[model samples]
Target: MSLTNKAERSLISHEEYEIVRLTHHPDIYDVAGEDLQATRKRLRDLQEKERTLAREKRRISRGKAEPRGGSFPGTQERPSQRKQVFAAAVKRLSREIDRRARIAARAPQAEIAERALAMRRENFNASHAAADTANEGMQVIASRRRRTTVHPGKVGRVSQRTKAAQARRDAKG
Candidate 1:
């Protein structure tokens, strides 16, 4: 079955699907913006969704429910395969949730480090004011720009094979 059809017919709610979709994007954290509390809430919601998906997946995997025939809503996949689809969705969502949660957990520490650096800069500037005045008449030579180790041309280049591999990986996950 096609990927979009499978995802659309997953047992997860619309909001949960949207969250999972956003988490797959490269710039997901940027979409969350500068709000730490909002990030926390989003993480909470995702965690809850993950838990729910997991429960549903577990129930299906257990075979406690009777196997139903026919295609699921909005998909060509048979109802019998809904278990696999839910499992795949839960696994993908869980991986992304873990990654996002780790980044979100570190955000506060990053903010603290930034504030400490700012304070250090302020103190350094206050102490260096006199030195700055003493060197006011001196001619300053411009420093050479530092060359980076990474080549720009080699950055972010994904081969067609790699793209296909990723697509397969996503489908499986």
Candidate 2:
């Protein structure tokens, strides 16, 4: 038999530190023996835990609580109530589609195309509304500035100069 140093022998025998260079089998304990009773107990315990966890998750997801009135988060309306909301939305959409189709059929081709373009832009209607409000606010501020200014003539001259400079920069580009 070959003799091994204390360090090498300890490493080879260690449960956690596997000697891959010595053997193809990484785990020496598995090659040595297995506790069937312990494995069966562990598997049964895991299965029981999984079943309990699944049941608890389902209960939580289903929202085990008293139903209170009117649209609240995590509370679903009944089928009839949902059908009413769906019907209203569908009716509104159909009305809009019919209105647009009528306009397209009656109007000139160019006018119809323009209307369609405008409707497509209206899809981001909220953003356009915000921009319009901002522009109106700026115009109000500008009018107030003009009213307060001591020299209205100088203000107009300065504005003309600024516009000419901007125009020159834009033309160069």
Candidate 3:
């Protein structure tokens, strides 16, 4: 008979409130119908429920209405205790809706990341193959290139001995 359980039980099915189980269970995200439209719809519904609970809690606190439990001494139920239950329910719903939003936001990003990784892997494989083939072609082209030869001539100025020999040859001619 936890207050959270009581609050959950009071809510209608349309409100989509589920009882908080005390036992340990996996956090099963309801992502099956999580398209953009569906996500928006669910967020709206959860926000509405949260707002309703908050309103009720406010009403009780403002003394506009009696809280869920009896204020009688025999029952020993306090108004503050009742308010706390609704507050907890509202907080829980808020957290659930926020988690859903985060999950929805991440879904597309995850898909894009997977696609990018696949593209990178494909490109890497292609580049490696191309490089391997190109290396052989490059070696073949290098072998076909003409070999360089050096000329046995003075680079800048002729030597004095070569100049005198040239003069004697010209005088004989």
Candidate 4:
């Protein structure tokens, strides 16, 4: 009979019967009718056989020996350090902007106001430039799956209202 047909004919599968048969077999018996040494030897032999099989499997998987040297140098900085530097720079710039805005609000004269606006624009540009550098650095550290958003300062379009107001103010001046 075929192996499959023989297995089907048995009370249980061939594999299951083998396991049951092995479990019931006594390897050695002492004067007290207890098998200690035989059981230990059998268990040890089974464990050694399993280890040998595992080693063979690993050797088969790694067909060729791995190389010992030739590691590439990493260029990217840590995310936390980059974030800390960016945050500190942004905070300092924000405080400067608030201080200038307050001074402009309190001061009188169109010339002073224009100067303040110019200073504000310069400050904004400088901060954005730093932020752009940080963002580029972040691209190297950030996950490949993440998407980047453009900063408002980097956007080139001027609003219609802003353009119209600038025109009116220029005409008045």
Candidate 5:
């Protein structure tokens, strides 16, 4: 919606298109119909329209991110053409499902976890900077069971545990 890609969130893809078509775009999911291509075109056209809108929305948004609604082109007219489009859509949908599953199984949990932590910190405190993302990063890494040095450069920021350091110095003083 609001360029969730920047937030490291998943974007709708072929699977979503399938679901949308099944629930909404019945003209595109007619398996036994003769107008397969027309359905596929409808699906592709919808996705293309959504992507174009999202790209434009992202480009236009400069401040707090906002969501953009995608507009769909009208439905297919010729039944034969629709069948052709749908046949292709089904084939692409199958391949995409398999591809997406493979990627889901190998998702980068560490980077995503780090980004989520950073986003949360930003949401809580507008002043939260890269330097303040350390402890949260560690928590993410630990939760995910990933082994890493947790170094500033590696984790993308420095730790902000000033209270602990201050207490140590005060005791010494």
Candidate 6:
């Protein structure tokens, strides 16, 4: 994620936390549910789960970001503890993104082909057969429809007389 995205996400999370916090107010909880502490804990737990999932996704998607290598990455000294914490968090996210970008920049080769082959050998084999069967059913349905529907013979020349002739033939049948 971009720095802006991280900042925006944090702000939004703050807003959401506030909303959850407000829900615990005595007036609201009288109708909503009276377990203020439990509700807060539940919201906190959900937020933690979300963070954990995002962390895992970042790990999986690692090596996509363009790394800023002008100065030494980890050597940037932090004066304050809070700055150090934020810097570390940002560094981790940047590393994941940058790591992939570097690898992709090197040019694709046998590795990509191997991965594709591995995927081809996996769970989609059944689905491929299923798709063919579905298409066959659709084709038969389409053929049946074409045989039954009345179509203009000479390309948009369905005159009133022509329609009447077909209608009379239908009435007889």
Query: What TM value does model 2 have?
Result: 0.20
- In model 4, the Cα lDDT at residue 23 comes to 31
lDDT (CA) for every model shown? Answer: 0.55, 0.42, 0.51, 0.42, 0.48, 0.45
Q: For model 2, name the residue pairs that clash.
A: none
TM-score of each: 0.30, 0.20, 0.35, 0.20, 0.24, 0.22
**For model 6, how does the per-residue alpha-carbon lDDT over 14-42 read when each residue is reduced to its tens digit?**
54434343442253325222344454455
Candidate with top lDDT is 1
For 67-172, candidate 4 gives per-residue lDDT tens digits of 3335522311232332232233234334444555677777667778898788767565553324335434321222258687989775655676689889999999
In model 2, which regions exceed 4 Å deviation? 1-73, 109-173
**What are the per-residue Cα lDDT tens digits for candidate 2 across 106-141?**
779878799878865655443332334643432111
Clashing pairs in 1: none
Q: Where does candidate 3 stray beyond 4 Å?
A: 1-77, 128-173
- Each model's backbone clash number: 0, 0, 0, 0, 16, 9
User: What would you estimate as the lDDT of candidate 5?
Assistant: 0.48
Better of 1 and 3 by TM-score: 3
Candidate 1 yields a Cα-based lDDT of 0.55
> What is candidate 6's TM-score against the reference?
0.22
Q: After best superposition, candidate 2 residue 73: deviation in angstroms?
A: 8.5
- After TM-score superposition, the amount by which residue 141's alpha carbon in candidate 1 deviates from its true location, in angstroms, is 24
Off by over 4 Å in 6: 1-34, 63-173
Task: Report the lDDT tens digits of candidate 3 across residue range 1-173.
Answer: 34545454454232343322211124333323333345445545544555665676678779998777544233122334434444454454455657778998999999999998887675655534343464354211123568876566644246767899899999999
Cand. 4 Cα-lDDT:
0.42
